[model samples]
Target: MKGQSRRRVLQAGAFAAVSGAAAGMTGGRATAAASATRPTSIPSARKSGGALPFLEGAFTPATKELTAFDLDVTGKIPRDLDGRYLRTGPNALGLEDPRAHHWMLGDGMVHGVRLRAGRAEWYRNRWVRSSQVAEKLRETYPGSAPADDFACNTHIIGYKGRILALQEGGPLPYELDGNLSTLRPYDFRSTLKSSFTAHTKYDPAADELHAVTYYPTWDHVRHLVMDHTGRLARTHRIPVADAPMMHDFALTGKYVVIVDVPLTFDEQAAQAGALVPYEWNHHHPMRLGVMPRTGGTVRWFAIDPVYFSHTLNAYDDGNRIVVEYTSMPAPFYAAGLGSGGPTATGAPTLDRWTIDLTRSHVTATRLDDLPQEFPRINEHLTTRRHRYGYTASAAEMWRAYETVDGQIPDTKFTNCLVKHDMLRSTRQVRRFPAGAGASEPVFVPRRGARDEDDGYVLSYVNDPDRGATDLVILAAQDFTGHALARVHLPGRVPLGFHGSWVHDA
Candidate 1:
């Protein structure tokens, strides 16, 4: 049965690559140390004891709190009575207030849902008719719209008591007014098309609010300052030469940092031994660019990025600006063989870098040596004041690349989280149990709570043997190895792409 299942998966993967679904489909693992790889199968329900074994001497808060819920949304395709298609799942919603009660916005896809603090009751109805946006998109993209409800790709942000949302494909700002039940939707699509990523930032010196734009395809960043009334105040067009085709960015008080991942079709084609068309090779770049928030000229530099930085993804921590990355070089196999050939070979590297803005210098460091066991870092998990926290993933994972000679294939990979100290250049590392998936850990810090240790670290561990993903909530302060709570997810939360924290009331 195992052998038969492995063959079926390999066939599906080959078909998927030909259909161009390779990029969107994630979370595939090697079936066995010797067998080939396949898309991970979701497991049935199971329970966990809530103990994370590796968080030793990491966080020592006064209390361990489950202030907010780490909701997971896995996409399920279902057919309607008329045999139409539909998608259902939870998305990453941005919180608008200090209170954990309301969620200001919803992503409306597998991981796109969000809400305003204290507004849990708002999602009871679909006030913003997704049908309307669907019509607009159908007219624009033609043939791309599928019948049934589609994802809006919305984002919620908070600034000076005001809440706003940037829908997925456009740059229109809607006045949320802390109400999702009767949301006052305005037609602001004329301002911009295809809003890849959005954030509400404040300029203290000017006492102004800024709504930023992330262009994922073309690799550009734009800023539009708006008054309290939601009126556009000023527009700044910032051009980037080496921004990642992936469109990830960060913002500080005085500067905006743009990062570009260097995954290009040309490189893939070169490795695949085929000639890829020019249209597919446009956005690839291998560099990072720094620009002043006020917008004059931009300065670009090259860096081999391994993973993305946590919240603010890029930030200035007093002395230096640190951009954390997971380092994995393009293996010779991928470059030599392409999609139809053998798998990539070699170990991966996960490390962080401190870029000195003042002197235009950079320093790289490894995160494997900290005192704590697990360090959590991603686009969403960052210290409130950008202090010390954990960094995960960005490390390397290896798998069986190919079968050679008359000998069996030998494969090895490492999955560990690090507790990194930004100020002192130190980190602690912890390895997960055997046969667990390499997923980032979610750290929820306690705010305004009596017991400082009352925070919980939420993570999903995919047990390949059992074919299930377990949700483990551990005491944040008990990084020295303690268990607080554990539960089983109803289904697998397809390895998350990113996460964030919404503090409590």
Candidate 2:
């Protein structure tokens, strides 16, 4: 059979099997399934036999929805700062089998901190209400029903007056209010026919949002663009051999960088009940394609097989396209999402790939040897040469767990936030407290700022000792100095994926 027909058959078989299983289950079993899907107040304490690394420490989910006003602040918040810092991540409420729970398979929970005129207005954390969540809470489903009812976790951003909670691999974006309340599943006013991605690049020059999205059930991915008015303006279908997990992509002045890594969908793994059924395939060729932003034939360049979760930035430099990102060795090699210690290829590092248009070749280089991930740069520099980039230390984040065989010791911890000066070939690090962990650093440029680094870096630092998280603001130009301000939150904010600084309009 052809690949498309084979995929359709497989999907049908899986659906039938699930339907049969549900039909055959007793009332108790049905109750159990419902219970498993509900969000718990807090994660249970770690078991004596060893627990999942993500379930403990800073990765634990907040117990309940919280709303706090007049947040305590240390130092002074910039008077010019005005907007909300919103983030979302997997926060598992209840797990039937904690041992089998993957870090990326949890319910979606969004955390937000509102800032205005030098004051921390409020901090709120709310779960994005999927159908299951709404059913469990005995409430009506919010907004338009999604094509799929999976949690829209991973990243959150504000675009065209809409705050969207996004996820990868086949879920629609959930819309939230300015106060972080789940409004409904948004689909560009019914313009989107396929799934949306967790990451979307905004081109200020064109006033549009671009994304490369993928779904496991499809044999191809799509390049989607939304106009400045929040309308789905374009969709380009790109064919591929297999269903690759394109978690994130990059956008430059001329092209949208589509990375096809070694990680592909595993039908066997899915049938075997793996929560995240994608794994590394040694046989799969790793490559990247650069497609013209305005839509044209894609230029493909083969690269070494590797994995990366996020891209810092990409831009055009003469005839060469420069892309900087965090490179990892493998995915789910040991178990779960980035569980187990570092692989033989070493920890995740800041790497660069220069695609030469003239030579039709790609040159890979290591920009920084430091183990780091969750890279961010000034949004104003998107699709342009940028001087500074920021990343959270991955030294402790990824190496926190021992191998499944228990060969290495579990020394789970969090480290510093880093500022890299690409032009100067130097970096300044700001280490957090001993037991504290920080989320991805978001760079918010000052209003009417002249230089690229003239902004404030914002992060949610989880302080285990205090059982709370703080939104830390650092002067971008003064990287190693004391924080400009720390807005102490009332509850814990788990280490999450990505977020954006939504400026007030």
Candidate 3:
């Protein structure tokens, strides 16, 4: 059984490494009167667009129907690293790369899961065998063709008994040690980016290891502080304006917290870049910034006028600084210009937000709307927090029409899984009425289930007009009432950008 669950997660990390409470639960300390006050100054024109006040309806549906499970393991979802900005479609039925491959794509194997006695262990991110990306994609695209779904982009963090692995396509910062698979090369002067697309953060109390990158030809946010054997101790720069970037960032101790989203290179080249010259007329503004974990000075906070497609989780809820986004409502600038103008024919309402960085602003919430003529927002759905609190997944926009025989909304779209409970703030929208395909969810946590509010949530729903794909499971405390089973899968597996669940002991 996987060598007795990797020796019971190395004997429960040698009994929690002598009980420092799992290294203070992955280390992070806050308090200097909560980072020396000074929060409250947000409104760089709250992005204008007044008239939108209507709160009251925090989700309520659970009539009763909970029971889910179907961990069918088949496997096939990982391919994309050719970069000319990577593009491929027509086969695998029309693959489309969703936000950040594995969301940071690799660094301690994208820290996903690791339980043990209850069981689960999955790791992927191959191509180190004297690398050369499939012989340079067959000697420079001699008729392009390579997309059998490979996988990597960060992962491998076991601690105490050791297991590092965070090799970002080699430039610096590499370590693979699942108990000694020994793939050396760990330098760490930071600013490293050959492809593991930065988004890492570890600070077992200053043992340090942070990351950030996003230059877009100098919009600024280079920051990289390392240690814990990776070396490089500091590097700075955090000036943000037409590039509020950083969709995900957090580090409690010295306080990092970056949850930005002010991007508009003509709306990132109208939904997927291609006009260059740094988006001529520029207009990327989504805000929430804070810095100081040793690189002083930076404090931005603006909200309203959102249009984020994914990733936005910043925390430190010890008196506010929550942040969690997945917003929608802006795209009609020729629908982000995928060619065809008139804001590319409008429609995309889906809303969500919850910022409060100590009162700097933000509190718009209104999930349940994506029929605005398919404006697209299933950018791989992801927003996390657990122990029984927040959870998210919402990508519904089907519209398949060849002359329509049934499925139709924009031609077959699916993505639904929304669990929330910000201390009873409400929310639980699950789905499977026979349609779903956007994948990016994995929240096990049931072992010793005496009702720790029960738990289970794995996903990867597909049907792309019936090529087929499934691996569903839900019921994290009755997610909107029941779906608990589905394991189909024999072909078609493209819909990946993030996955993690390595627990089996």
Candidate 4:
């Protein structure tokens, strides 16, 4: 923000060499050939003021793919628990300046652990092969390759029969094996053309995967619909007007909710070699567009300024659509990344935004003042009226961040997991010990779960001081109680973006 090219932090001195080698490469190529590429680290390409906070400490990248068998468990694992827990983060490959680095601009690495019959089987980590990565991997590059490359970092999910790692505004998705190895290209059977978002929703009734995606070349954001069998169903271009970075969206029983925040892609910034191409442009004007699930007329509603990527849940509550999220004064750009940003908005506070369908107006009310984020709920309750909501403490979310200046400011990473009872407006919190941090809570329904809260909340707990990471599983109904099980891993896992559970049949 200090100079005309604030984003040059990504290009200029830091990325000049790396980007030069990467050349025209961007996003990533998720092909079978990429799987053969090896991961190499750059001796240089580090930040001056102590490698951006994310590339250090808990956010440090792990080199080897250590395989641990029969992990030590602190508590009894539920007999019904069966699946692999996988998460992804921007674990940068090598050779770049840390000074111009943005936390979200690194290559993708996925950390995964498997469980079966109440036993912890194994743990593994793999990096998604982006176009920038092949040069680091392929000692001898492939002669020809696909043009659509991807970062495949931000998020991962198990859809239909595939375990796909995804990133917003990139190639389709990267397919990973059950062991978290063998990364390959995925495009819903060659159905996708350009891009997809990090967050995609499923409609059990219709067995359809839905997402509103944005690409640099597209003038409008388009909705992607895939059938239950993982086949592309339809693609409809929505006229949101300008190209805004739309991270996550919500689904009502009949309508899809899209939030057009201030973050937008800048061609000039990108051409300048800024790794993180998007910048906040208030001129874009923030708005929520409500359109039918099948794609038709959109009822647009204007709202106050807030940049929240993840929404807990949204449903058709009578004639009003109630959407819940951790709304902040501004996006994380204010917290760190650079200076002269809107003053730190404080923690992202949980709030409920009610959209009146008939009147086309939005009414918002604060649900809780305690900053919390990554709101999740049981999949069965999505798009329908229900009660339970889960999240991590907002303080712990950005604990490793630093302002443009070289100062270790006090930051709060969600050190606790919380459950929000929407109907009653009450909350239950399960806090970790001092100096410990938690990951986003992924809700897993019990074998015969009857009630909305009848499930287990799963998250990774990292204790850097002790040098260890544990997958902590908590009974949803009794959140504050001891974890049902804490599957401990061999080493510390860098703080990451997101993950999901792939339940075994």
- Highest lDDT: give the candidate number: 2
- Which regions of candidate 1 are displaced past 4 Å? 1-192, 198-235, 241-244, 260-285, 302-313, 317-320, 330-349, 369-385, 393-417, 423-430, 447-454, 463-467, 501-505
Best by TM-score: 2
Better of 1 and 2 by lDDT: 2
lDDT of each prediction vs. the true structure?
0.35, 0.72, 0.34, 0.68
lDDT ranking, best first? 2, 4, 1, 3
Q: What's the distance in Å from true for residue 245, model 3?
A: 24
**Candidate order (TM-score):** 2, 4, 1, 3
Give per-residue CA lDDT, model 4, range 6-86, as digits (tens).
Answer: 323222111100000000111111111223335445333233534354555555565544567777788888888889888
The weakest ten consecutive residues by lDDT in model 2 span 16-25
Q: Quote model 4's TM-score.
A: 0.87
Q: Write the per-residue lDDT of candidate 1 for residues 262-315, one digit (tens) a residue.
A: 532232322333321111222354555666767667666665544332232345
Each model's Cα RMSD:
14.8, 7.9, 24.5, 7.1
Write the residue-wise lDDT of candidate 3 on 334-358 in tens digits.
1122211012122233344454557
For 1-505, candidate 2 gives per-residue lDDT tens digits of: 3344333222221110000000000111001111223346543435625645556555666556777778888899998889999887776765555665555566788888899989998887788888866765677885566546566777888888788888766677888899887787788888987777888899899898998988777888899999978889999888886687787899998899999877777777666655455567788889999999888898889988777667899999999999999876655342343441122234667999999999999999988876677899998889899999998863335544323433443444237788999999999988766656677899998888998999899988755555677788999999898889988777777756678888886
Model 4 accuracy (lDDT, Cα) = 0.68
Clashes of each: 60, 1, 51, 18
Residue 113, candidate 3: alpha-carbon lDDT:
19
Whole-model alpha-carbon lDDT for candidate 1? 0.35
